[model samples]
Target chain A: MTTNHTNHRTNSSGPPLIQCRRLTKTYKKGDNTITPLQELDLDVPTGDFLALMGPSGSGKTTLLNLIAGIDRPSGGNLIIGGTDISTLSRSKLADWRSVNVGYVFQLYNLVPVLTAYENVELPLLLHSMSAKDRHEKVQTAMQLVGIADRHDHYPRQLSGGQEQRVAIARAIVTDPTIIVGDEPTGDLDQESAQAIMDLMVQLCEDLGKTLIIVTHDAKSAAYAKRTLHLEKGRLIEAAVLAARRAPLVPQEA
Target chain B: MRLLPFAYAVRNLGRSPSRLFLSVAGAAMVVLLILVAGGFVNGMSRALRATGGEHNVILMGAGSEESVERSEIEAGVPGVLAASVAGVRTRAGVAYVSPEVHVMLPVRVGAAARTTTQSSGEQAAAAQGSNTASMSKPKGRQVMMRGVTPTAALVHESVSLTEGRWPVSGADEVLVGRMAATVLGVAEIDVQVGKAVMIDGRPWEVVGRFSAPGTVVEAEVWLPLADLMTATKRETISCVVLTLDPYNEETGEGADFGDIAAFTKTRPDLELVPMTEREYYGKLANFFGPIKIVAWVTAGLIAVGGLFGGLNTMYAAFASRIRELGTLQSIGYRRLAIVWSMIQESTLATAAGGLIACAVGVFMLDGLAVRFSMGAFGLMIDETVIGLGLLTGLALGVVGALPPAIRCLKPTIPVALKAV
Candidate 1:
């Protein structure tokens, strides 16, 4: 069955918000050299919802991490919003990521001792906003994610779906340009997974946030405007070309 | 800049309550040891230094400069020194020259002849005046006893009759120190005023009790010089204690100790060695140097052990939270931010521990009497001691936590996230 993707209008005049040309990441594990992402090229315009799908060990998370600026590329260029993040210093890259990307995890990596409000306020603390402003922004973000009622509850006190909502609230609190998810719904049940995917879609459509999510579930991918598949360490060309021609559908092999 | 919200560091400590308690306990132990060591040295030094006046001089038998108890000078030495030294202080035309005999005399607590214990049970029994029922024979304990003339009061200003009248001269009257009853082997309530003490098989009436606060004299009993000489059958005194006129800094010529030194040199038959009381006590304090060093060494070794224990605990705690730290890093926190956060957590724990240790020290150790070779001294856990304890706790926090924090945060975000 096919799922409908949002036909959000895009500005085709400007350069894409994110661009990767021959981007690569490799590591030496004892005697074997492992390349998680190699020679990859992609363009993600602002406000685009892109789903990354692949099997285990298929470098899906690696590409997501590189795009989020959490991992540096080993070779080639990764230009995000006209800045080559690949050449930035570690500290500079961290500062760049703080304003440019917000990451959501499958397990909801909220500090266990901090309340939902505190977890959502974490990113805002990196900025120089006044306490009143931070409070306003955190409340707005939590309300938008439908977790405002549980803002005082800790992560352990909330259900899986509620915790995921808090995690999303934390992501968008900084008003970052892109929100990257590494299996954002991997741990939730089908209904909760659909709810999280729908919230992510809302974040993109309503806030103009570029959403890139790593997921293996076809239903989770169907919420995106386009779904791209990676095998081994390279993106499959046929699937990308097909996706460019139409809206998102489950294209898993 | 604010690395992480301080609340983040503070609240993170509550995540592992048991581990936090363990680390805080370790830090507290180190702080306590340092505090106790400082108190020991401070109390002992104060007890020795405060016992003597700077204007007073001591005359002991030659070659016995270390201990007045071992010195044997003729009883007429004080008279001759007072007559010869022009700067010898006199109050109301009476020279402040006190000829004293320092000796150990048997202090009888009960009639049973058994040695007394310092145990609370025995002290309680002694304090209750129940000696008649508990004793079948005389129970005696030897305490440091001083044979002093009345002028001893003028020479040693710290001593004062706290409870009853001072003993009259040439009378079979003895005065006990306020601390004498608390001394081990003599927990006797009978040592107080109006009671009779059996010394050398002779009954001496206890006419008074005295206190010399913060001085070693607080721990000694006093009796008339003639009575003690007759009772102990000794014609010699331990030392001649003399108070001199204060030096005139303006004239540069008054009450010189050089006059007493010259008098000792002329009277070769007396075999007298003279020194200022301050110098004598200074030497005595130096003699206890090894004890002070031992206290310091013990505390230092214990502190090292505590530091390692704290470090190992932080290592394990940080190991389990590597992924969390990585997540923080991925959320745009710099590595230095995480390090600062870790330091803040450790310091907060140790600071809490320091407060606990201060409470323990104040309630448990302050003013608690300890018996040393010279006499007994109460631990002085004053504000200075508490400040030192807190400083030590903070130091332990930084020294014990920073290395492990740096090591744990060394890995990159990707590598750290992959950790379990």
Candidate 2:
């Protein structure tokens, strides 16, 4: 599917922003080895809105988590913005993720005890910015997400949509280069899900953030500029699924 | 790097109020136990040391250095010492040598008074050998009886009459020390001036009350020496106390410690040992030193137990917050930073408990008297004790929380985030 806002304001003239070359992730569970993502190759350019669609156990979230740097790939070179993050130390990866990647969870994983403002301010606390500067950034981020008035409300006090908006505010407060979402609107109502997708579209088109969303909903995927389908930890052509789902042409008698 | 906000750690305590309360209460108990134990040692040591005076000398049986109460000397020893020691101080032309008899007579409160106070476990054990005063109930609490001569007033200047007059010379009158009731674990009204105490099956009226603050003497019941001797049919006395002449270096006529030591050495027939009052009390203090150490050790062991309890609670508490910790780590907080925040939360809980413990100890435990074999002493919760309590609380917090905090945060971000 093609996005309506194809023209972005921020600079997009660059090589692929994220490159995954044979990215693999394997783990052991009680002597049973499990490979979630095996030898996967992918590239996401700057200012691109990409959606990943797959069935259960298809490793969509695993790929998203690896891209977000919360999980490391096994036996692969995963490079983002000219840095081979697979080779970086754990602490160095965390630092890199803090500055370059903003992540949103399906459940809108806001700390229940923290107010919306404090939740939005969490990412900027990693920087050496002054309090005033952090406050301004948090305010701007909350304002951009159109939830500034609900800043003091805790996650439990806010609706699911409002909480997800706070989570998005927290994501962009640091002004990260890439935003990764795992089932971002999975738990929301249809209207709220559409609203969140529209917000993501706006973030990519206006602010030039590279967005990679993992979802199973076709309506959600329609909002992205390009969509990829995966099955059994390996990427497959979307045209194949479209062709299968397309109605058979009938001969006129 | 930036630290985790203080507000986060503090406000998170409200998440589990019962858990927070239990942690705080446990910490407070440990701190209070330490304070009470330390105060006991301090008060007992001070009481023992304060019993001795610099200018007084004690003469007891040669072999009974451990207990003056058990020491026995000839009745004429005081007179012989008075005549032999020339430099002894004379007041109003009379020598200041006092003959004293220390007897541990089993005493019981009056029948009317017995119903008002309950005997402690120790006193009940002591009352086992005695007969019931009324045949309807057990006898009142048992106590130690001290028999002293009139000259004792001059030798121990700390003794001051607080209520009523001193016991008559040859009568069955007795005077109770202010802390005697506490030592006996009886009601204060049971040992007041108007009360009567039965000693050796004979009733002696409480003619007066005396106080010797901060000394073991405050735990004794003082009676006439002649009366106690006649009643118990004892011809021998316990010890002889004497006031020394102020030492004059130039004239060399006043009583010198060297002269007293020589006197004890020359008199082989007397079979007497001479020691300064300070030296006697110093021996008593040393005798109780092991007890002080035992109190501290018990408190330390309990504190260690409290530490493990705190650690377990923290483990569960921090384990439940694994996802929150993962969130912090994913937001770029280092493992050590999260560990520090956990420590801050534990420390804040313990420190709050410490403050409460200190206030409770000072108000409830301080000046509370405890009785032992030798005498009774009040608890001393001074600055040192308070400081010790705080240090214990802080240590409990740090040592207890560190391991759990580190263990909870040990997992990688994805693994921790996966925790429910």
Candidate 3:
């Protein structure tokens, strides 16, 4: 058995922070099978802004979850940050995801009882951080998201855009390398949606973080540096574009 | 992971204020019922046991251990045999032995309206007449009258003279218990200071009024042993109280009362029985045992029903929040954490109910007296009953919360995420 040093070098050179090689996932529905990912191959380089666009049953969210290690693929390998996530135990996978990926949902799933600062401090509680450090990190995250003034407000007391900004602060408070969003603006009006998308863009480009977003809105899709279009569980189009393709219209903002 | 979910649980409960109020009210009612029933039973038992004085030793006829009131022994036999018994303590070289007769008779107040036609003023006049006439007649309204020797008071420490003094030796004087005096409307008669009472058409002077340590004696009338015998026309004593030296000391040989009663059979002329005072009252109180049993059984059944009602309320409340639980799961709380939060929420609600029940019991039921056997014992809300209520509340909370938490935790991420 000869040691392959060249193969090792190649693996080290192309070490995508998140790599999905021919990943597939299927669902069973009353004796019929629905394939959500069909041999899907994708590589998310470190600090890249990628958008996923497709119709309702087009597997965009499924691919995002695979990259975020929220779900396992039935076939092929999922490598995120030099570790095979598919091979990790469920608990270990959760720990890995907590450190590596932060999620922002469309509905802004804030615990309704907690104040904005407390909600943002949730992820850090899983670590060994002191209370003072947690408080500082939460304050800084809220300040960065421009919702520091509303730190004591509950989710129900905040507006749509403000709540979404709180959710963004929660996702980034732990300072994870990658952020995954599932239709982050799906429930918002044009103005709130543009504001949320703009926040995501700034988090990725200015903060030097990777972002993977799943959306159907072309306006939201246009904010990313790359857009992958999926159809019938397969990637049909992949395009690389400028990070700021165009400024959102003032009226929408 | 922290108490975060507890806050959420509390807020969710408060979200629908009416439902929360109804659930808490139902639990409180059940707890209150449990506490009241427990207090009643405890009061009854205390009343019964309180009748036995610490220094008293009851002596019954040998063949009839069950009924001290029905037992008969020759009056001379007690004084003679009591001197021979070992462990018989003496205060001044005289053993504290008292042969007594116990009898029950119906008693009514003299002030009970004599006729329907009498006006309140005329009724008062009639009541005064009846009270005066009662002094001359031997028996007016009847009551349970105990016939005791002067030494009886020495054996039973509970007997205390509230006015006047104990009857003189060989006198036809009687001492009425304080409660009997109140019930008979003769509290101011200077009962033991020679006021007269009638028994069997023979007037007997009251020499004193006494209060016993407990409620039982408060319902009795005490008279001289000879007068009670003549009034009732009974020749035999019902029972005897014998004082014994401490078991550890040696005043004489330790004679078993049971063996002495057996020894008397050889004479063929006398019958005797022997037992401790505690054992005698233990039998006398048997009638109340079944009542207590039935009370506990009924309370337990009602408690079971309340538990199920509580469980159903929690299940329904949690069922409506499945989407919220799923959201929590997606937000990275472990299933165990969610379960713990649910349990904490249910416990908080049930504990609130328990506390309310205790408050209601203390406010509405404490010190409320109920008459039984012509005596009254105040309802006692003890610590043990309160402890049982709290334990039941915690059990209800845990049992109620488990099913819904398990249901919430079972589904996969996709299914949970899709719950909305």
lDDT tens readout by residue for model 3, A24-117: 8887889999998888777778888889987788888988887777677888788888898889876676677768878888888887768888
For model 2, report DockQ: 0.54
Top model number, DockQ:
1
Location of the lowest summed lDDT over 10 successive residues in candidate 1 chain B: B111-120
Pairwise lDDT winner, candidates 1 and 3? 1
Which residues of candidate 1, in runs, are more than 4 Å off?
A: A1-13, A239-253, B104-142, B169-172, B185-190, B194-205, B249-254
Give the alpha carbon lDDT tens digit for every residue of A101-205 in model 2.
Answer: 888888888888889999999888889889999999999999888898997899999999998999899888899999988888998999999999999899888
Model 3: residues >4 Å from true position, as ranges?
A1-12, A27-35, A66-77, A87-90, A238-253, B1-13, B37-55, B74-87, B92-95, B103-150, B159-235, B248-268, B283-290, B360-380
Better of 1 and 3 by DockQ: 1
lDDT of 1: 0.84
Interface DockQ of candidate 1? 0.58
Candidate 1 Cα RMSD (Å): 6.3
Model 1 docking category: medium
TM-score of each: 0.89, 0.89, 0.78
What are the per-residue Cα lDDT tens digits for candidate 1 across B100-194? 99987656754323333333346476687656444544446567889998899899999998888888877789888876765534455656687
Clashing pairs in 1: B111-B137, B111-B138, B112-B137, B113-B137, B113-B138, B113-B139
Candidate 3: tens digits of C-alpha lDDT, residues B1-420: 333435666776775666577567767877777887788787767656777765457766767777766788887877676655555557776677888998875443333322221333444677755554433333234456788887887887777888877776456677888666544544444343565655553356677888774446765788888877877788989988876554443554444445444545554565665666766666656877887788888888888888778777887777766666755554555667778888888777887888888887888886556556545555677898778777776777787678867876676665666666
The RMSD of every model to the true structure, in order and in angstroms, is 6.3, 5.5, 7.9
